[model samples]
Target: MDTQIGCAIKASNELVKNLHRDGFDRGCIATFNDYMTTFTKNKASLHRSLNGINNAKNGTRLYDSIVDVIQIFRNRGEVSRPWILVVVTDGDDNISSRSLHKCAQETSSLFTTKESNNFLFLVGVGDGVNSEKMNEMASAGNFIYIHAKDFFLLELIFLKIANKITTSLSLSLGNLTVGDHSASWAEVQRHRNLSKVAIDYALLIDVSASMNSRVISSNSVTNLNSVITHATRAIGQSFDSRIINTTNVALLASWIDKKRGNPYNFSDLPFEFKLIHRASRDGFGNDKFHNNCDNKGPTIVVIKVKYSGEIIGGYNPLEWRCVKINEWSTLLPNNHDFYIDQQRRTSKSFIFSLTNQTISRVTLNNDAIIWSRNKGPCFGLQDLCITNNFGKSEQRSYENRIINKKNFEIEEYEVFQVIDKRPRFSIFYFIFMIFMGIFKIIKFIFMRLFLGIYWTCYIVYWIIYWITYWTVITLICVAGIGLIVSILALPIILYLYLEAEIAWVILSALFIYAPILGLIGEYLVI
Candidate 1:
């Protein structure tokens, strides 16, 4: 038992260091089975004492162990940092007074009081382990339930859990709305991929004559038009000078004529071709973008920006522009429409400075743009791929098809591939099992049966309604058909039995009349 604890701790320590995660601080180590020892910071002494420790005498009290850990967190008064509680058990609880539900509630409460980043890991090894109880004891987010038939797999499971924790802590998206903003944090955490991929991007910039003029309301060192134009030009220059010439980049431009709100054609735009190339075709060919990026292996990306005049007031408002990308779209209009700048009272202008990319810009929408020093593809591109698989150019669309044996082929795939990976049993399966078990016990105690009586009554009702109606209707239809057949055969029967020529004449008339009557019945039903 002590060896397992030492092995898990050692593996976790090594993983944290190897993954470049913050080092872990040694916390209290305690064991409980309807009883608990005081938590000690001296992990070395605790491990040394583990060998002498004997098997717990009583039944496994999983709840008590969880409560002890929660108590330790409360005593330490450290609510800001992340804490993890790992419970390893081999059998079900039998003698503990504390119910499993109580333990889960306490676990949830403990984490709720903190920053909500705490974790719980329940490892159940060997047969007779109660998987349901273990799952119940684990709090939702970052918590995991691992089941292994042997102790040998425990070490591997611990290592996997440690790796997950390390990866989660490494990618700190400062203010990016990924996990915390979602309704289900556990689901969001499951699909998070921190890996970076190259991107093939398109940039469309607005460079109208308005960009060269000063703001209508203010005096500034630089015109609102020049700020965006220079900033965009600089961005284009960086892409051309810093990036490889073979990089897949489609540049387009939109412009305004002398009239306000009147957009100009790409050819009429008065801009240097060196800064940006005009789009050759309307509705940019998504197919060609992927083809150009195939050799380079860059994720597909597109961005369109429109400068809609200047924002009236704010700390960093002058250079604001409405930007839309394939991954996300924002209408950052250059005006105070969402909220009035109460601080300025009257609308005032802030000088636009495009030097620092990290300097927070003021826009109607409070979205922050992450600028990379490497001038890599937009970071939001990663979010799009992780959440929606939006940038996988190799993925074939509905229009894409293959001909096999000179025949057209249709291919189908799972929509939510990530969610589909998780297997689920029908809820009715559990309900049936639980209900049957409880009903048997109730019948045994009360000397009265409920299910059997209910089933008998239901069967009797079904026979009275459905069976009687179907049987009577079937008999009536069979009789009617038999009567018609017998009536037609009567003439033939008389001719054989009576030995009369008149019987043959009656036989012909009977056959003709039977057909006419049948046709009349059919027409009436229709």
Candidate 2:
């Protein structure tokens, strides 16, 4: 015991030295067995006190010591510095006047304060220590519990605690080698390569000027405008980018999803493009445009200026719904005009010019898209508005004007709905999927049946096991009671009758065979 006490004191002194070296210059050391003695933060004084603890104490008052340490910290008043309390015990509490519950309450109250950073570590040493009780106390106090097999391991444990405290107090670069740094850079490059933007784009070419020209074909001179119109019609088979295979829908999807913070990788899925409304097909009526493209998710409107040959368009993330006159009136009570344009707010809206290859994002998030009953899809207050096939472009809510021309007649205008493409499956693949699903169902049923059988057998085994165990215990308890009765009666029988050899023999038999029977019963139960 004395040697054990000396080892504990030596380990504690080493811990204090290590803590002081690790920049924890000010700390309190409290030693407790039956009673506790605290030493303030002086290196020499702490060492002297630790060396003076030569004798070993008999009782362990663990709970009482914890309360005392908490009280000492509280008496220090308010402190900005971090507080760390380390409690080491070799045995369970034997002389603690303070209940475990009371000590836990004090510990919790002391540690869970916003005043300063507080840390508590409870360490149990040797096989005699009650680890479960220590764990419970640590959990209640919101501290850490550590167990050491012997007193010799305390040095390593204390050193680790000092290192932990130092690490928490300071910040430093991690253990990354040059190779690791290079590997990290390579990973970043790989991520950048994989994270390319997905896009859905349309090319609107101007062929209006070709109307006045003539083209010399292999047979004869033909009208160039007619040939051009025929080519445009052939290209306008469907707005489906996959069918066209000219524009990169993946790039557009990636860009949009990234900007909107959507985790979905649109590049993995093909885009379904449908030309909802074309001015040539549906006439240049605003009502017709809204009726066809109103509830459609996202649409791209592209216009080819008549003479300038400038191709400009805007991306509306929201559906274009015409605001009712009554709703518009309520929205803008000050406005007297019969025509009221509904301003839609969105940060994702953007306009671009194919000719200039410039994209302008909406500067003012609010009023990004405007919807009017009289005008076809309007963007940013006349930034770009189409009414009866005539379009106007003026920079207002957007960063830059996509088209220089303020007002121009659209040679051709098309609105295409941007949607995720549905996967096409072959008949064979569909049949395979059906078979796989059936197999999965069969597997699930078999697994459930197996589990049911296993649990049933397991329950039966435990039932039999408990029954045998109780029978053995009952026999051992009866034998113990009989042995006690026989011993108590033998003393009286021996004093009362001098020639009680039969009773002596019975007593000897009971003492010898009772233990043998109990052992046999224990073996059977086990």
Alpha carbon deviation, residue 244, candidate 1 (Å):
46
List, residue by residue over 1-526, the lDDT tens digit for candidate 1: 2333333334333322232211224344445532233434443544443433334344565566666667776676355556666666666766456676556545544553343345456666556577655543442211345565544344445445444443345464333231221212233233223422111100011111211222122323343333323222212222221111111111111111122343332223433223121112211233332223222311222221112111010121112122223223255454433321111111111111111101112221222122222221212211111111112111111111111111111110011000111235578878998999999898786665666787899999998899768866765676577578777876776665577567666776576466656655654564
Per-residue C-alpha lDDT of model 2 across residues 295-320, encoded as one tens digit per residue: 89888786656655455678899989
Q: Given candidate 2, what's the lDDT at residue 36? A: 38
Stretches of candidate 2 exceeding 4 Å from the true structure: 21-24, 33-39, 173-436, 439-526
Q: What is the TM-score of each candidate against the true structure?
A: 0.31, 0.34
Error of 1 at 325 (Å): 35
What are the clash counts of all predictions, listed in order? 1, 11
Best-matching candidate per lDDT: 2
Whole-model lDDT, model 1: 0.36
